[model samples]
Target: MNAKQIIVTKNSEEKEFYSEDKLRASLRSCGATNNQIDVIISQINAHIYNGITTNDIYKKAFSILKKFDRTFASRYSLKRALFELGPTGYPFERLISALLKEKGFKTKVGVVLQGHCVTHEVDVLAEKDGIAYAIECKFHSDSRATSNVKVPLYINSRFLDVQKHWNGNSNNGTHLKQGWLVTNTRFTKDAVDYGKCIGLTLLSWDYPKGNGIKTNIDSYGLYPVTALTTLTKKEKQQLITRDVILLKELYYNIQVLQNLNISANRIRQTKNEMGKLLHYDTFTNGTR
Candidate 1:
C-alpha cells in the first residue's frame, strides 16, 4: 500500500498522504523513546493501506505501544481518552479540579457564586497562595472544534462581575482573583489574540503551543481515569460518575474498583496500569 494514498481523519476529512515524520513526532511528543518510536513507525509503515482512517492508524500504533510500554500507550491515548469523559463534560470538570489539586491548589467543581449582578456557576475554582481563579472548562467531543473568541468574551464578562463583588471579601483569602478559560480542544486564533490582549488565561489543548493542556497533563502525570485501557467503558463511566477522576486517585484507592464490581483480576490490572501511568519518572523528561 502506498503511504501517499488518501486517508480519512477522525473528522471525516481526507488527507492525501500519511507522513512518517509526523507519526514519529507524535510518538516522541507522547514520550516514546527514539528506538521505540522507530519501531512503531516501521510497523505503521508496513501496515499502511489505502483508505485507512487515522483512527485505525492510532489504534494500530496504540496496540503496538501497549506491547512495548503501557504507560507510553496511555499517554499517547490521552486526547482520545479525554473525549470519552463527555457528552456532559462533568467528568472533564472533575478531572480538571483533580489536576489543580495536584498542583497544590484547592479546587472546587460546579461552584455557583453570586456575582455583582448575577449568579455564575464556575466549572472549576482553584485557590492557592492567596490567589483564587474562576475557571471555565469547555470540553469538546469533536476533535476539529475549537474554543472560539466569544467564549472568552462571555467568561471575561462574568469574571469581571464576580471580581467586582468578591474583591474585598477577606474571608475567602483571595488577595488576587483571575479568570481562566480551559478547553479540551484547540483555541481559535482570534480567541488566542483576544485572550492575550485582555489578560484572560486560555489553556487549550495546543493553543499556547509548548505550554498547553497536553503539556500540563504530561508534565504533572495527571492522566485521567479514562486513560486506563484495562477498564471497560461502563466501568470508567461508573468511576467518573462517582468522582474518581484521576488515575492517581484510583491508584491510591484500589478498593473503589471493587465497589464498582470489577473482578479481582481486572482490579489488579487497573492497579498495574495506574502504577505505570502515574510513575513520576516516566513523565519527568516530557515536561516543557
Candidate 2:
C-alpha cells in the first residue's frame, strides 16, 4: 500500500504521505546521517498503517532515532518538544530570551513599557549593538495552531506607539527599535505577509526556511529541557515552573531533581539520559 494513501495529518487533513526521499530530506535537515535516515525510514515503513497522523509518524521516528543517537533525536524533536514547555508560556518566553542572550543580546522578559497610547507588557525586550527590539512571543500548546494576522496587527500597533514616545537611552546608545513576533508554531500566510509589509520580524517554525526558529535552536544547541525523554511530564513541569528552561541547565543542576522528591536512582537515570541526549558528560564536566 502507498504511504500517502494511508496517513492522515494531525489537523484531520487527509493527504498523501511523502515518499522516503522526502522523509530522508527532512531527517537530513536535522543533521541525521544517511545510514540513520535509512534505518529510521525503514522502521517507520514497517509500522505504517491507515489513518496514522503525522504526529504519530514523527513520534515513532523520533523514538527510533533516540535509540540510535539521542542528540539527533533531541534536535529532531525540537518542534514538538516546544509544546511541552508550557501549561503557561512563561518558560517559552524565558527560552526565547535565553536564545537571544546567546546571540549577545541582553534580554528582559515580561516587562511593562509605557507606549504613547497605553501600557504594553512586552514578552521579551532585547538590546544589542545599539538597537532595541520589542519581542512578542506567542506560544501554542497545540502544534497545529498558527499565529494569525491579528497577532502581528496588534503587536505592530503597540510597537508604533512605543516608538513614537521612545526616549533615547544614553547608556546603550540605542536610537533604533524594531518589533519582532516569534512563535513556537508556524504563522499564517496573512501574518507573514503583514509582518513583511510592515517590516516587523516574524520568526516561527519552518516559515522562513533556513533562518527559522528550528535553525536557530539547532545552531545554538539550545534544546529545551522538555525534550529529554528521561523525565516524566510531572518532572518536566516541576523544572519549567522553577525556570530551568534549557537542557544544559538541567544537566548541570541535577541536584535540583532532589528538591522534586525524585529518587537518587531516578536522578542518576535522568543525568545519564540527558548526557546522551545532549552529547555532553553530565557527570564529569559542566557546560558552563
Candidate 3:
C-alpha cells in the first residue's frame, strides 16, 4: 500500500495524506544522512495507516532515533525542544536575547521602554550597529497554531509607537531600525504579507529560508537543556527553574544534576551526549 494514500492527522487538527518527501525534508533538516533517512522511512512505512497522527509518528521515530544516538534524537526533536522552553514566554524571550547576543546584538529581556503613546514592556530590546529593535515574542506552546494577521498588525502598531518615541529621544545616537515579532511556531500568509507591507520583521521557525530561528539555533548548537532525551520532563523543568536553559549552560555545571538527585551514571551519559550535541566531539551519522 502506498503510504501517500494513508490519511494522517496533524497536530493542528488538519488531515492530509502522508507525504514521504515531507518526512525526508524534516529528517534532513536535523542532519539525518541519506541512509539513516532511508532506514527511518522503511520502518515508518511498515506501521502507517489511515488516521494515524503526526505526533504519534514523531514519537515512534524519536524512540528509534535515540537507540541509534542521543544527539541525533535531540536534533530530530528540535521543534519539541522549542516547545519545552515554555509554558511561559520568559524563557523563550531569554532564548531570543541569547541568540541575538550571539549575532553581536546588545540585548535586554523583559525591558520596559516608553512608547510615544504610553510605556510598553518590551519582551526584548536589542541593539546592533547603531540600530535598535523593539522585539515582541509570541511564544506558543501549541505547535499547531500559527500567528495570524492580527498578530503582526498589532506588532506594527506597537513598533510605530516605540519608533516615534525613539526617533525623538536620540537613543544615545542609535535609532530604532526595526520591530521584530519572533515566534517558535509558523506565521500565516496574511501575517507575513502585513509584516512585509509595513516593514516589520516577522521571524518564525522556517521563515527567510536560510536564516531563521531554527537555522540560527542549529548553526549555533544552542540546544536547550530540555533537548536532552536522557532527562525526564520533570528533570528538565527543574533545570529551567534554576535558570539553566541551554545545553552549554548545563555543560559547564554538570554537577547541578546531582542537586536533582539524578544518578551518577545517568549524569555521565548526559554529559557524553551533551558533548556530541554541542559538537565538542566530532559529529557522525551512525550510532555511537
Candidate 4:
C-alpha cells in the first residue's frame, strides 16, 4: 500500500486525525523494519489515547524524538513523520523561526522567488547587522544521510536559490548574504565541504541521550543529539542541567527579537558572517 492510502483518517475537532494502526501500516508499507515500528509504537503508546488525531500522533512521536535516544528512535523515521505531518511544514518552520529570532535576528517566513512562479517555503529568513540569512531546518535521521541525498544537496543549492530571489524582478537583494543548514544529525563529509565551497554553513547535533540530553556543542548550546548517550548517573544528571541552561538561553534570545525592529539588509549581512564563522577551519584539519 502506498503511504498516503495506508493512513485512515477521521474528522475530529474539525481536523483530520489518523489512527495508530494506520500509521503503523503506512510505516510498514514504506519498508520500515520491525524494530523501527516498535520504537514508533512505543512513542505512540506513551501518549496514545482516544481522540488523538493524526497530527496529534505525529506531534507526540516527534516530541519523543526531540532527545537523541540511541535506542528505538530512528532519526530518519522521525524526520519522515515530521514532514509527513505538514504539507506546508508548520512545527518545523515555527521551531526554526523561533530559534533564529532568539538570536536577535529579524525574520520573515515563506519568501516568494520569481521564475517558474515557484513558491519556496523558507523556515526562517533572518537578518542582523545589515545582512540576511536563509535558515533551512532539516530534521532527518542519520540513515537519511544516505537515503535522502536531496537534504544536503538542497542545502548546497540554497545559495543560488536565494540569490535568484534577490536578483529576481523584485530586487530585494540588499544585504542578502548566506544560508544555513540546521539538522538534527551530522552532515556527511561531502555535504560539509559543499557548504564550505559555496559558503553555506551546516549546523547539526549529536544524538541526544535517552533522557534527552544534547551532546555536541555549537552556538545553540548543547547539541540535541548528545542528550541521549550512555553516561554515569551523575553525568546524565549533569547533561540534563546543561540542556536546561541551553534551552533557557535559547528562550531568552528568541524573546529579544519580539521587540526589535530591523531591516532585511542587516539580516543578510549577519547571515554572511555567520557562514564564515561556522566554516572557518582549524589548523589541524587543514581547512579555512
Candidate 5:
C-alpha cells in the first residue's frame, strides 16, 4: 500500500492520512540531518500500516535517532519524558518550582496559602520583584489527557479568593500577582479561551505556540533528568527521587551516582552526557 494512503491514529483517537512532510519537518527541527531524515522516512514508509499509531511512529523514530546521538534522541523524546514524570504529580510540581528558581524567582512547592473563602494548596508559588504567582500544575500520565475549560474556571475562582485577601494584606504590600494553570499536555480551545478571558496564564506542552514548556525548556537549556537518553527509566526515576530533577543538578553533583551503585565507567558516561547537555566539562578538555 502507498505510505501516503496509510491512515494514522493519534492518542486522542483522531485519524488522518499520514503526512511524510509533517514527520520530516519534526525530525528536521530536532536536528536530524537530511541523510538521517531520509533514513527515518524510508524506514517509516516500510514500517507503517493503516491504523498504526503516532506513538509507534515516535518510538520508531526515537529508536533511530538514539543511534545517531543521545542528545538528539532525548530532545525528540522530551514530551514522552514529561509523561515519565508521573502518575504522582509531586515531581512535576517541584520541576516547575525549579524552573521558576532558574528565572530568579523564589519558589515553594505544595504550599498551603489562605484564601478569602477557605485555604488552598498551591502546586507552586513563585515570587520575584514583589510579585507572587500561584501556579496549578495539571499532570497527566496518559498522552491524550487534556485540560478543559473547567480547569481554568476552577483556578480563576481560587485565584480570586486568594487575590482578595492578598491585596488586603498589610505586610510590606506583598500581593498575589498572577494565577497560572500549567499542564504537561495540551489545553482545549475552551480552556485557552476562558483562561485568556479571565486573565489566567496557561502553559501547556505546546500552548502559546513557542512559549510553552517545550520551548521554554529548550530556550533555558535546563532539561529534566527524564530527558537524558543515557539514563534508563529506573535510573531516571532514582534521580528524580533523589531530588535531582534537572540535568544541571545531576551535573553539579556527580557523586550522587555513587549512592545508586552506578559503575565508574557508567558514571563517566552519564557525566559526559550531562556535560554536553549542561555545557560543562570544559576543564577536562583543557579549555578552562
Candidate 6:
C-alpha cells in the first residue's frame, strides 16, 4: 500500500512493519503516487539503511525528492509536510520570531491582518524606536532551494492601505514603517532590484546550526540599513509634521495679507465719498 493509504489505516505498531519497505514507502509518504514512485525506483542503483526510524523516513523522503523536478518542491509541498506532522500546529511564526529576537530586535508574531478574500497573518512585526516593520515567513521544501515573487508588490500596496486606515491621514505612520520579505530560499536578481527601487527589505533565512530560522545577512539581497530608514513609521511621521507646520505658516501669511488689502480698499472708498460731499456744497451755493 502507498504511504498515504497506509498512514490512514495503520497504528504505531503496524507502521513499524512497513519501515523497511525503503524507496516505495518513503516516496509515497512524501506525496508521490505509485506511478511516480515506480519511475524513481527504476533509476536507483542501490538503497542504504536497512532499518529506518520515523525521523530517518522523513529524511529519506526528502533526499529522494531532491532527485526530482524542482516544480514539485514548492512552498506548497513544505506546508503539506508541516500539516502531516500533526494538529497542534507547526511553530512557523515562533520559529522565525525567535531568530529576530536573538538579533536584539523585538518581534510580534501574527499581528497584521490582510482581508477576507485572503487569509494571511504576517509572521513577524518587528519594532525599534516606536516604529513597526513587517516580516513575512516562507518555509521552503527540503528538496529545493528557496525562491518567490509577488510578495514585494503586495507589501507595497498593503502598506499604503494600512497607513491610510490607521494613521487618520494619507501617510502610513501607524502601520509597519518598512517591509521585510523573509524566506528560506534566496531571491532572484530581478526581485532584489525591484525591492531596491521601491524601498522594500528582503531577508533571506537559512536553517540555523541548532535548527529553526537564522538570519543570513550577507547572502540576503536586502537594501542597506541606511536605505530602509526612510520607510520606517517614525521617519514618515516626522515628514508629516514638517509639512503640516509649513502649510499652517503659509495659511497664516495669506490671511494677514487679505485683511490688509480689505482695510486699504475701505479707506479709499471713504475718501471718494468725502470729495463728492464737498463738490455738492459748492455747487448748491453757486460759488466757484
Question: In terms of lDDT, which candidate is stronger, 2 or 4?
Answer: 2
Candidate 2: residue 176 lDDT (0-100): 41
Q: Which stretches of candidate 6 lie over 4 Å from their true place?
A: 1-90, 114-120, 169-175, 206-288
Model with the higher lDDT, candidate 4 or 6: 4
lDDT (Cα) of model 4: 0.48
Please name the candidate that would achieve the greatest lDDT relative to the true structure: 3
Clashes of 6: 1
Better of 3 and 5 by lDDT: 3
Model 5: per-residue Cα lDDT over 159-183, one tens digit each: 8898888888787346688899999
Model 3: per-residue Cα lDDT at residue 236: 97
Alpha-carbon runs more than 4 Å astray in model 1:
1-16, 168-172, 280-288
Per-model lDDT: 0.82, 0.81, 0.87, 0.48, 0.86, 0.44
Worst 10 residues of 3 by lDDT: 279-288
For model 3 the TM-score comes to: 0.94
Candidate 2 has an lDDT of: 0.81
Candidate 6 structure lDDT: 0.44
**Candidate 2 vs. true structure, TM-score:** 0.89
Write the residue-wise lDDT of candidate 3 on 1-288 in tens digits. 688899999987899999999988888777678898889989999988899999988988888788777788899998899999889888888888889888899999998888899988899999988889999999999888889999998888888888899899954588898999999999999998888988898889999678888888888877888789999999999999998998888887888999999999999899888888777852342122
Winner on lDDT between 4 and 5 is: 5
154-245: candidate 2 lDDT, tens digit per residue: 99999988766665334445744799999998888999999999999999877688988888877776788887776787888888888898
Candidate 6: residue pairs that collide? 146-185
Give candidate 5's whole-model lDDT. Answer: 0.86
Alpha-carbon RMSD of each model: 3.8, 2.5, 3.2, 16.2, 1.9, 30.6
Alpha-carbon shift of residue 96 in model 3 (angstroms): 0.6
Q: Candidate 4's residue-wise lDDT over 1-288, tens digit each?
A: 323333323322443334557667655643457776778777666655545555566555545443433222332233332333232343445546655675788887666543233456666788898787777776543223421345667654655665665655355645667877776545666776666677776665442232111222334432221122222234323423433222233232332222233344543332232223233332333133
The true-versus-predicted C-alpha distance at residue 33 of model 1, in Å, is: 3.6
